[model samples]
Target: MSDALSEASDLSGDDSQDVMTPTELIAKLEEAWLNEKFSPELLKNKSEIVECVMEQLTHMEENLQRVRKGDVKASIHRMEIDRIRFVLSSYLRSRLQKIEKFFPHVLEKEKSRAEGDPSFLSPEEFAFAKEYMANTETYLKAVALRHMPPNLQTIDMLKAVPEPCLDSFVFLRVKERQENILVEPETDEQREYVVDLEEGSQHLMRYRTIAPLVASGAVQLI
Candidate 1:
């Protein structure tokens, strides 16, 4: 089956090729999901693609179970199945993390703060948001009713939520050089520094420090 999956593309001389195994299909689905996750324009209508991929995954799981019971050698594919499942789960969690970052607006409990007031989520994301809303509301109600201690009243959901900004301590390379780039200092008693970027020069800095440069295409995220 592994060999078949690798050789399946050569079976046809046309632009299209068949995926011979669940592994190959899941890999392709993961690629598409990652692409959709990064592109906001496609995210708005990504529900159909997500649903189709999920259905395919379910069918693959069912077929795998039958194969396992009928053939001893099929047990070798268990690792592959587990890996695919992990990838699928991680993909979903990554998207959910993003939705939770903007949960307030997604729940429609807050006014629009993003520019253009566009929805950066798909229908599947909206469902996840609804789940989050239900859980939060339930918790708040319990707290207000004194079912929980008053000590938990000061817990702010958003306060625990990490900033959706770039992470720290990541390396980045300059894509387009610009001089006189101003940056605010993070600590007291530190002098300000102007960025004199040069194309192709790599620098090891906190991602937050260079996030603006990345957004402006002056630097590349590595």
Candidate 2:
């Protein structure tokens, strides 16, 4: 586990007094989200992390209010609180982008046989997405059915339609060298030598083939 994760793991809901500060918790969550091998357990614990952050934010707000009333020492804490809020917002934005990419599917109402890998998302997250999609579909259908043209009225909802994720070809830069890549090249000329990649090299290859390397941080997606 990375240092941030290790620190996060050490914290528990019951041990409120000894738990990491809100800033540290946010940092840990951010790092975990960046990792390709994000744990389902982390998703499960998201509520607890959010609760902690909210409590801290509430306290910060109280302090800021008091400072506005004449307390000067609380000014420093206000700056730190604002910084943490910015980081927390950024962290949420990154997760939102991923959720947006999948949109209604995250809500899961219509059910797509070709659902993308949920390995990166938690069960709770998937459930919440489905709920959001269901509500949106309900609202749009009610509104659009009246406003939309005759032919377009029967249009399939984006969530109900199963669209394939086009991630087959990917561009990436090597962050670390790999002495051997198990994947084989089909051509006869490439069969004689094993695949070797050096650091700082950039290439476009099959996303599935390089997924493990990306997860391991050996390569970064471009």
Which candidate ranks first by lDDT, i.e. highest?
2
Q: Candidate 2: worst 10 consecutive residues by lDDT?
A: 36-45
User: What lDDT score belongs to each candidate, Candidate 1 first?
Assistant: 0.57, 0.58
Candidate No. with top TM-score? 2
Could you give candidate 2's per-residue lDDT for residues 1-222 as a string of tens digits?
487667655454555555574457766555434432222111212445556676677766875775554456677777777877775666555555556555554444325425663344445556656666667667877987658887766645564555435345666678899877655565877753457778999877666666667656677666
- Cα TM-score per model: 0.46, 0.49
What's model 1's lDDT at 61? 73
What TM-score, to 2 decimals, does candidate 1 have? 0.46
lDDT for each residue of candidate 1 in 103-216, tens digit (9 for 90 to 100): 655455323436665454665677788788668767776757356566765545555544444444555667687677655577888777877768888876666666556545
The C-alpha stretches of model 2 lying farther than 4 A from their native spots are 1-12, 15-23, 32-45, 63-72, 109-131, 139-222
